[model samples]
Target: MENILEKLGIELNAETRLTGDSKFSFNCHSALSCFNTCCSNLDIVLTPYDILRMKNRLGLTSAEFISEYTEPVIQKESKLPFLKLRLGQEGKCRFVAAEGCTVYGDRPAACRYYPLGFGIYKNEEAGDDFYFLIKEEHCKGFGEQREWTVGEWRKNQGIDEYDDKNRVWMEVILNKKLYSPELEPDEKSLKMFFMASYDLDAFREFVFESRFLDVFDIEEERLEIIRSDDSELMLFAHQWLLFALFKKPTMNLKES
Candidate 1:
């Protein structure tokens, strides 16, 4: 997820590239000398999937959770809106504690892939995704006895599901990157993107409670799923953006 990595100040290069078999030593438990240090004074950008899980885990509505815990950011290249975790006093993540992350199970992809940055290199032809290590001076976990290949590390961190759910949102950002240096999103479009991408509950209301159905021809079955399912709705929201932003025809319009 370039969206997550770009903010971490990691760049993709020969030294950073990882094959599935690439291995590294790391162990970050409460016993580390630098325990919970990385969680503070850092830039951790949250993906939409990250918000979906954290908000649901904390039992907060999308808008409520974001308003309370996220700070808005705009990617320089894409001019797109993004949300970073709002660090609390001492510059620590709101969810971070002496015991380590309070929201560990529902942590962001950036947290899940900690000490390793993941990204995709894309062009007009095709794209290649890769991982890179982020060995910071403060981290003693890397000096531990444990070692893992990139694939093993990913599996151990349970990052596959996050990757799967975040794929579409990643595509949206990457798609915009294709037009960078010249990418300037309109205000209304940015609002729409933010609402659809981050504010799921508001987006749900906009779709079912607004005249959205009157304009777009969504099937009844899919409608039922998105009506109550946040995950499905998030997926639907990205698909709608594909149509709204790029005119990708991901959704059909009702014929008069």
Candidate 2:
């Protein structure tokens, strides 16, 4: 399922967007003719956490993976900059193989959520999320014996792990949308955002090898963790973004 929600309940369309309790039948494997068909000619946006998992899984630096496998794009409506998986010949995904995904264990979030679409609607509180079917013509997974509620399918697909890791990055995007007059991201700011959000190695350099240490009063304990841990560094990067992008004072600068 495609989850834009951080917590429970969501996707769209009264007719197709399903509730957490809504049930559906579907399954996919090499036994079916449409086994790997859904992996091609698609627009898959890479979330920050997706990048982290994938680059490390392939033993590649963020810069190398992005340079070789992805292209930068800006959404027309949201104007939020993100990376898209660059399709190879015939509009096929780079990771698709004769059997299945080469990076199946580290597949991107959108890939894991096929045949299910998810969305969100913000109210005053935590907000409501929903799900829907993405029934492609080539897909025959719908005819299989598997029956599941939206929540069940999400659980079976192991999306909670992805959602948990990506929660903070999603917040940054949502916060961007709430800007008073809207934030038209510039070249420099966009580069900074990408570095913080997806380029962990680059961000590491920025933190330890640049004036970042001089400008921010980071605790040594936290520094020690971020230095060796990519996950911790990614979180620390998100904290820096909140301050740099919105001046939220998340990081206290050294007294000048």
lDDT, model 1: 0.87
- C-alpha TM-scores of all predictions: 0.92, 0.88
Which candidate gets the maximum lDDT versus the true structure?
1
Name the TM-score of candidate 1. 0.92
The sequence of per-residue lDDT tens digits that candidate 1 reaches over residues 68-158 is 9999998766778899999999897889878888899999988989888775765635456677888888989989989899999889998
Return the TM-score for candidate 2, rounded to 2 decimals. 0.88
lDDT of 2 by residue, 1-256 (tens): 2343222244344766578899999999899988888888888899888898889999999899889889989856456678989999999998899999999989888887777876654333645776677777898999999999888988888888888888777777667443446557778877888899888999999999999888899999999999989998998898888888878767899997
lDDT of each: 0.87, 0.82
C-alpha RMSD for every candidate: 2.6, 4.2
Q: How accurate is candidate 2 locally (lDDT)?
A: 0.82
